[model samples]
Target: MLRPAASSSSGRRRRSARSRHAPPQRSAVVPSGAPRPPQRLPAAADADGADARPAALSVRPPGPCSPRWAGSGRGYANEPRRARPSQRLPPQGGRGPRGWQRACARACARAPCLGQHQPFAACRGRKRKKERERVFSLPAGGRARWLVLPGSEMAGLTAMEKKLAEYKCNTNEAIQLKLVRFPEDLEDDNTTFNPEYSHQVFGDDEVAFGYKGLKILLYYIAGNLSTLFRIEYTSKVNEKFDCVEADDVESKIREIIPPGFCTNTDDFVSLLEKEVNFKPFGMLLHTYSVHNEEAGEDITYQIYKADMTCPGFREYHERLQTFLMWFIETASFIDVDDERWNYFLVFEKYNKDGATLFATVGYMTVYNYYVYPDKTRPRVSQMLILPPFQGEGHGAQLLETVHRYYMSSPTVLDITAEDPSENYIKLRDFVLVKLCQDMLCFSPGNLMQGFSQEMVMEAQQKLKINKQHTRRVYEILRLRATDMGDAEQSRSYRLDVKRRLIGPYKKKQRELAKMRRCLRPEELTNQLNQIDLNMQHEQLEESFQQLVSDYRRVLERLAQA
Candidate 1:
């Protein structure tokens, strides 16, 4: 039978000394019935002159797995209705989306041995000792789409809307026509002509081909920060949508038009019919709000709250907001009221640098269909800005195009957007409120509360003032020095140390690991409450007072040391 090794005389003395002097190892898991290690937590102020009992740890493990639809006790549910997530729009990646992170961490904290609530999924397949890191993105399917439409589709949608309204109102055998949207390359003429003079060159050659086409976009952001943008546009009238650049240029550009821009967009639709010698139809506009990392390793489109990703990820989201603000400025500088053809279709590709996925949006103005002439115009409508990530106007080229094309052009009646989803109704019945006053400074949605709890209520009006759903793009860029170049070019200032980094910082890794086991913010609060309760009970126990006093004295001595 095995037995403890016989200890030499000096060894036994050393063991006894170590046991008497060393601090006890505190752990989440321990042998049952072992006297809970003497509670060593610092004493609270109210316990002065009281005997201390064993200090119990204020932290505890997290609970069980949460349900996909509801188990997340995160504050997303607590946000005000307008801030709440929409069924059509999933929770895209963001920074201020509080409850999501908190719930994920707290929930995972309850797991028996789930690692820290930090970027748990980063570098998943990477070797710990290896120097190579990973770059993550959402899985392909999880990547949402953001569509960009051209002019032909917008004109077509206007025509279709007018025709559909007439058909819906009366019963008549009417010849119904469709919209025309086209691929950009087909219209390119193979020659990358100058953006300004190209119009002069193609003036007589189907100048308004894609004018009536619309852009449909969808974006998916998987748990592992990968991005996919899927886009489809109207190509042939009453036919299929081809998102590619084809050879059948003129005919293809006449399909896939979207709804409409102005109330009287119909009034202008007929003008194009006779002038352009082509019938116009309605179009579609769709956009997805999903985000994935660009440079991080381990492209997981996961929802594991415990998993941590890059810290710079949050900063990236911030850049999106900045880019949106800049877009608003650029558009406002050119397309405001009376100048009615400047309907904006902002495609924000703030997640990945360059995308292989498709995006859905802008069927009304991707190509040249119909143009309302007003030189000094109404500004941009910056339709959708708040995002899974901050908004990005793709890059400076988009702005430069606006200046060279729209701003410099005459007879541009910058039109206002007409949306029916007018549907920005956030969840109405919100019980959670995890916002700050400062947050309202940017996203005014936070200022509203006391919404009707009924779930059936859809937005009744379209003219509602959007909670300044805009990010200060120009200001942020100025602060970050991005005004000098495109985001990629501007952000090229990576730390020299990044390349010099031999491996993952050991201290950072250890801290991340420890945070996995650290108690949550709410739990810490609960522990303080428990300690208060225990102290109250100890006041009645005379002997406990003495123990507390002794520890307080010991703590004082340690502090002095």
Candidate 2:
């Protein structure tokens, strides 16, 4: 009853079951020490018995370049947190849950500073000491307290201990929120192209409406300065840039930005809407456009092989993965820190009036597994072409490009996709068929000879295709080789595929017989008889028909190719 998933939440877990290999890179980062302390949110309740309004979603300032205030107890500007208890009361009316949480968070931000004295210089140089101070800090409004708390005093408890205390105290009542602007308010055709905005606002599968951009930059704080982490931009445009100066950065970003952003509006929220460009920094991946006569237009696209070692890979992936939640059913983000996982990004290039623009087409993440003594196998984990780009052969191009990338690696054993969706299967079928057609071993004469070790060997050796996938290719190719006009040949091909489909049902029957240990032969026979054999046969036929239909489609594409 389990259909092949278009995307899998546990792609790595499935790969782990099949291959045992230490990832070339660490799957996760373990902090150097026992662990940092956890922050606590102060509790607050609206004095008025009315519902609280949801506050604006908060934006998590980039960690490295986070805005910091430098002043002791109350010296810093404290608009939200400086409110006295009397002022904290909901202005004679009820507030929303979001407002309530914000109030509690603001209160928590000022709690540590109440009548406390500490010198910031004492904890300035110590990494662990600074961490302790930051850990207890409220993610919001608490920036003011960073200047007052003694880092040493903050290192009193481990993260787990603090978490336990927070759990027992029920911290859910004071949720920390981030600033986010919903795009719903924008005119239907008004476009925003900032990758960071997309990250903060959209779910993975939720495509950005009227939004398109290829360049995603990530930045972090280093030595109290905002340092560029990496810049992932499409090279298809062939534009020049410099980000060293703040003004230069802004100017370069604005040049590529589409118009009608409402940037000049006086509304603070509209101002908060970042011009859809500035992104965290990362390496620039180039994209190429392929001319396809069949599609009737030239398709400009590129596949960037993203590496884990690349700066800002993690941040870029964090923003990029928002697409998974919105597009891929059961889609899960891959562990980018894992050296074994490889990310391939596809982008479409277009000219927007005067400027060259790029929009994300789709992407795939693959995990490379050690096959044994020397060879490696790359398994496609999750694949998604955004809904706008689907059915345009972009998926096939992405998959083939990945296959070609790994084909040159002598250590690669074979290429496989993990729990492929039906659409993915069809795409794979077409790509593999097109690839193998030129190989003499897959000629019609050899294919009609039936499945053989030669087909599997040739596929694995030449194309880095796995044996299981090779067998499937052989079946489809054989069907192509068989003429339906010959009844015997068609019947054999049907049975060959049906036997594979009926395997699980046959196994279930055997398992059922083994479970009838307490039943008499007559009773067991009755139980077996009650099982709907005709229905099972019908299911098999249906599956067979559907599969044949899919195979025919692949063959038709192959014929065209």
Candidate 3:
């Protein structure tokens, strides 16, 4: 018995030694129809196991061991093994790839015996390092918790940005205007034009928000001036999308156009058919002709002075004045019920279809304010030449005709303009200089003698020109007569105008002297600091140069006239 036990022990030891040094066996292919033996997944606890994977990945859901992982020692007996990367299922709940990554991070954080296992510890370390890198890479004012948006939320933001980009439009380019003479004019693309400015109608930004491919079309008949307004767009932002409201284009146009305008194209065309019967309103004040270089013929034009009393004139005046809002920068309609308000309209007389037709060229409004005694000051309130007729010398003819009409009135004191535009001021200067050039006081010989009381008296008595205008005319005529190449003559002309320009500075100085007597010492110091005499001198020199430049332009135009 001792010999048999010794031999068995010795054989057991020899067998153990042989197993330690033996090479691993290869897996054999099984027959197609034969049943294979069950395969077991390697335990996650074994560091040196051939098939070991991370604990977080191994414990992921949809496996039998996943649900029991919180209470288990190793794994469930019937647990399904993890699928290969090529056969892995997509993440649930439509979370996408981001969700899968987040789920793995959470698994690593909640893993059992995380510190005791090498795979879990490595996963946790990698996750922490990635988190630290992400947090540190953010902008200075950003918080890690809210700075990074989820994949779904990020996609939503991208869609919103695209929507905003798709809807924005410039109001100036989007709005088109046309003057339709016949039915064919509407179909002609040549008739369509855009307003130069839209900030007056829209906001300062001039952006028509919340619309895609927007167009606001306004049409007016060439003769009767009947209107057709419409809006078009591919898409508009609505309450369903939580976007800003589109600009109220119709309301803005309504504020300028009168209520009697036709909104339909058919109705407007019908109105246009009746334009042949539309004649000049009130009494015919003056008639003139302009040579149209394009037409190679003289175009006849007539001016009419009308009040609210003429038949159909009130409605016509309303239609005429609507152009003021478009062309004039600071225009407002006057109360025509007052007898003092006078409307002067210019119309082009032409023969169309064997009948005489009158097209509106332009119009002006005058408010006769009562001066003391028996005189009336006729102030030019608003003047507008229709855009189609502008740059055609219609404005010059209209202003001169109006001046001649006003010149005939003995009760009129002088002509003035209410907040005249720079263009209007230039127009007035040209007209006044033209009229004054024919007078003895503004003769070339008399102009060299400098501005005089005789010039003022004659201008006020005959032309009803104010003292201010008389001074301007005298300067223009003087500039015309001046031999600018001669330094002595040019120096004399400049000194005369500069003397007038220096009056304001002298007046300011007198006021400052009075302030020194009245104001406190500290107040006087502040006031003194505000007035830089050197700057004033520089500004005065600039003003003189500008005035001289303007005078030279007037001379050039006068030479042409």
Index of the highest-lDDT prediction: 3
- Where does candidate 1 stray beyond 4 Å? 1-356, 361-376, 391-400, 412-561
Best by TM-score: 3
Q: After superposition, how far is residue 344 of candidate 1 from its true place, in Å?
A: 4.1
The segments of candidate 3 whose C-alpha lies over 4 angstroms from its true place after superposition are: 1-162, 519-523
Q: All candidates' TM-scores?
A: 0.15, 0.51, 0.70
**lDDT (0-100) at residue 388 of candidate 3?**
75
Shift in Å, residue 491, candidate 1: 35
lDDT of 2 by residue, 1-561 (tens): 101223354765666676353321111111223332332222443343122221222222223321222222222211112222223222212232222223322222212232222222222324553333221112222222222233334343223123222211111111111112233423222222222222222223222111112222322111111112222222221111100001122333333222222222244233333323422232334455656666678877766777767675565555555545434556655656578888887766554345454455677889998878998889899887755456667777888888888888899988887888787888898888878877888888887767778888889888988777787788788887889889998898888888788899999789787859778889888878877889899989998999888888898887765
Count clashing pairs, candidate 2: 35
Model 3: per-residue Cα lDDT at residue 560: 75
Please give the lDDT score for candidate 1: 0.24
Model 3 residue 534 distance off true place after TM-score fit, in angstroms:
2.1
All models: lDDT? Answer: 0.24, 0.50, 0.65
